[model samples]
Target: MFKKILIANRGEIACRVAATARRMAIQTVAVYSDADTHANHVRACDEAIHLGGSAPKDSYLRWEKILEAAKATGAQAIHPGYGFLSENEEFARACADAGLVFIGPPPSAIQAMGLKAESKQLMEKAGVPLVPGYHGSEQGPQLLQREADRIGYPVLIKASAGGGGKGMRAVDKAEDFAAALASCQREAINSFGDDAVLIEKYVQRPRHIEIQVFGDTHGNYVYLFERDCSVQRRHQKVLEEAPAPGMSETMRQQMGEAAVAAARAVKYVGAGTVEFIVEQREGGDMNFFFMEMNTRLQVEHPVTEAITGLDLVEWQLRVAAGEPLPAKQSELQIHGHAIEARICAENPDNGFLPATGTLAVYRKPLAHTSFQRSHLRIDDGVREGGQISPFYDSMIAKLIVHGATRAEALARLDAALAQMHIVGMATNVQFLRGVLRTESFSQAKLDTALIERERAVLFNQEPLGLPLAVAAAVAHTVLQEAEGAGRDPFDRRDGWRALGAAVRPFAFDFHGETHAAQLRYLHDGALYLQVGEVAGPLVIGRLPDGETEVEFNGRRHTLRVDELGGTAYIFGTQGATRITAIDRLAHAGDTQAEGGRLTAPMPGKVVSFAVKAGDKVSRGQALAVMEAMKMEHTIAAPADGTVEELLYVPGDQVAEGAELLRLAA
Candidate 1:
């Protein structure tokens, strides 16, 4: 191994790479932008370097700055962890020119698979299965429309240069093809600096399964099975798992072989993933088509690690050091089923809009070392009190669980998600939990459109459990007393109120609703309370584990509490939130009808505005589009009404909750 290596990335993946490097006794250097000066990856490294501004262009994407940092730190190699400069062929070549080893695939391999248009041609040349579409060099709109028509309706217009759902559009009809092409190209140019796009046949009920491939300079190669990445939103994967559910041995072998062939065609080196779009066939075997090859370590690599006993990062180091493949194809085996649920700071009920805030309460379940016993593995970059800035990806953590089978893995994932406590930001945790329990997912009947199809049922936030409410009531009372009295008033003899006939009435707010609770001291460190319309008294006790136990009307209820910065979190079936008890009269002006108006969900530059004042529009009509965190969101009319005002224009930067437009009801 080298004396020192630079991690050309940030967040969890950088920390993940450093961990394996540490075990290998290899010194690691971390590079950070202004936004991540105190990031977790920086703390994990043996040495760290600042890379200037917070914006990606000013730092992470600047090849010269990263190269200079690597040279200055005396790093002999660079590990591009999946994004930013990971798949940039020019960057890989620049590292080679700088006499530093690139810890991923060779520059040639990256060049071969970097562009979608070129990769499809290479796959077709290599005899790999491909979907029928246009990968031509023509850029004219009429020519592209012709190709889309030839490919059939529901074609996917995807940018040839980037991933992560940017510059990707799915057109369902010929009439929408022109506008979709323009939008895709515009996003493509802005995101990847490449307007070139490719048209592909959109597979109905598509299942994204990718094979993990490892290669060495000695021409030796092997496969680490496959991961099912069908759970997605906006064409980006939200959850992934190894040993794809309902996968047969024959199909696995075939896909694995094709993936290896695609890699070998480019003389690939190091770790890469060959993603295939599998179409479920009725009464027959599924037809798998080559999508593209990711020329670096994947974001969902932990799932692959969970099923196999090998450390992918360690293997990357070994291979980059000119070692042969660790194991042959026949020697590798899948031990158990593993599933990874990406816990992003997004609101599933609100069109999955990304949210950023301080992590007031972040707690992960216990993680296990091996796959032999069913266990949970949490890979995260942020801790409690950390901030999720608007400058980077909204993903906070990834919760992975392993079990003997897919069913067991799903069950563990569901349980782990239920136990997770996160506040001070909107999260898709509850949404993920609902997805795990959905009948379709439970049955392994997954598809790319599952989220869009079952969103209504999955995101329904109706109050379902009474125990949760009781627990919230109890926590609210305890926190209020703690704040007012400067300590737990139910501490010693002072807690006893036997000499008086007085009770304390406290008000609490949660989920836009209010409740009243009256508390009085009881023996044995218990507090008695009555909340809302409940007829009987409630007893609240704190357990040794710091969990709050509630007994309402003789019925015992258990709940987990996470307190941070005066925000109390009561975790149960009612879901998670930052709960604060306040006097209704004091903060009466805080409420607003912001969600009812067409506003920018996040701070971003307005890309386009389609409607003006007095424009009659129906619900869900696109009124404007805003780009934030590198993702474009179409702001639409909430209800059928006339546009009363247009408050924004193209090229305007608006803050979250800033009204961009208004519709008269």
Candidate 2:
């Protein structure tokens, strides 16, 4: 193995690669942008180099700068950690030209598999089952629309150059195809710098299953089973697992062999994933069609590792060093079930819109990050005070769990997600738990639309969330105050000298609704809380390890309470509830914004304005578009109105809720 290698990426994947490299006694170098100068990946490696500006264009994507840093650090190879330059064949070739090994597939393999159109053509020739669609080289909008009509509606338009749900849209009707295609093409250009696209049959009830394949310079190859990535939102996988539920060994072998064929067609080297979309039909019949091949390590590789008892990143390093296959195909076996949950810093209630903020309170379950069969692993790359940069992907960390069976894995995943607490921003911790509880997921009736299908239960507010959070918040305040007063005679606040109990009323704002709560400090060392006619005596105290224990409503519960910047957050078994604690003497005093103004939903760059001043628009008409975290969100009109003024032009950055235009009735 090489003495040192450079990780040409950031966030969890970069940190993940560093961990494996460290375990193998291979020193690693990390590259960072200005926004990530204090990032955990930089701290994970042995050496670090600063690139340029915060944006990817000015930094992470700058292949020349990355190569220079690798050479300056005397790095022998470069690992493109899943994104940025991972699939950029030119960068791979550049690394080869610079006399440094690229810890991925050969440049030719990346070239053949990078574009979905070409990859589909190659796979079709290789006799891999393919979905019926058009992957032809036609650039005209009318031509693409015509092909969609010829094939059918409910077609998937995807960027030929990239993945990760960007530059992809599914149109269910002919009328919506045009707009979806345009939006998809725009995203394609923005994300991959290629407007080229391919059409595929959008399989209803599709289960995303990808087989992990590995190859080396010795022409040796092996398939590491498969991962079921069916639970998704906005066409992106949210939860993934290995040794797919209800997978028969016969079908597994067929899919695995097909994936190997696709990989061998390109003479694939190193680690690669061959993705297939499996369609579930009536009477338990399933058919899988080739989707595309990811030419590098995957974000969900940990679940694969947990199940196979192997280190995939270590495999990449060794294969890049020209080592032969570690094990024969027949020797490889799936040991147990493993599940992975992608914890992202995004608001699941708001269409999974990305949220950016400083992580004021970041905590995780005590889990290992090794390939040691220890059951739980958390791969993260951000510190407590670090900001979730809008310039990069919004994923904060990955929670992986292993169990003896699928049911055990599901339970473990739910427990792990609840144990993972995050404050100072919105997360899908509870939402993920909700997914695990849903019948579709729990029963293994999986599909790409699993999240959308189970929207009601997943999006519903936790029962008594507001009141519980208020109680937790109040308990926290009371406990801290009582602790501080223990030393001062004049500040004795144990409800002893007071004639009546030391009762305090709290007013809190949860999302916008105000709630009234009363806390009575009792002489028995317990507190009584009254909210909305439900009065209960609460025995709340902070435990030795910072977890709060509360006995109320005839039940004992463990929770986490955090206060930061005037916001009180409680993380319980269900999920996180955020509320604001108001002063004792104050009213809510919250004002609602007028509906006459159209505003940006989140902080992002205004891509373009669909309406100018004096232009008439109907309700639900597109008014403008904004780009955040590399995805496009269109602002629409709330009512029939004429645009009175456009506040910002295209290319201007706007904060969340910043008025983008004035709409008049």
Assess every candidate by TM-score.
Answer: 0.91, 0.96
Q: Give the alpha carbon lDDT tens digit for every residue of 75-117 in model 1.
A: 9999999789999989999999999999988888988898998
Model 1 lDDT-worst window of ten: 462-471
Error of 1 at 552 (Å): 1.7
**Candidate 2 residues 65-158, lDDT tens each?**
9999999999999999898999999999999999999999999999999999999999989999999999999878999999999889789999
Off by over 4 Å in 1: 369-374, 462-467, 479-510, 513-533, 563-567, 573-582, 587-598, 612-619, 639-652, 661-665
lDDT of 1: 0.83
Which portions of model 2 show Cα errors greater than 4 Å? 489-497, 521-526, 584-595
Looking at model 1, the pairs that clash are none
Q: Quantify all predictions' global Cα lDDT against the true fold.
A: 0.83, 0.88
True-structure lDDT of candidate 2: 0.88
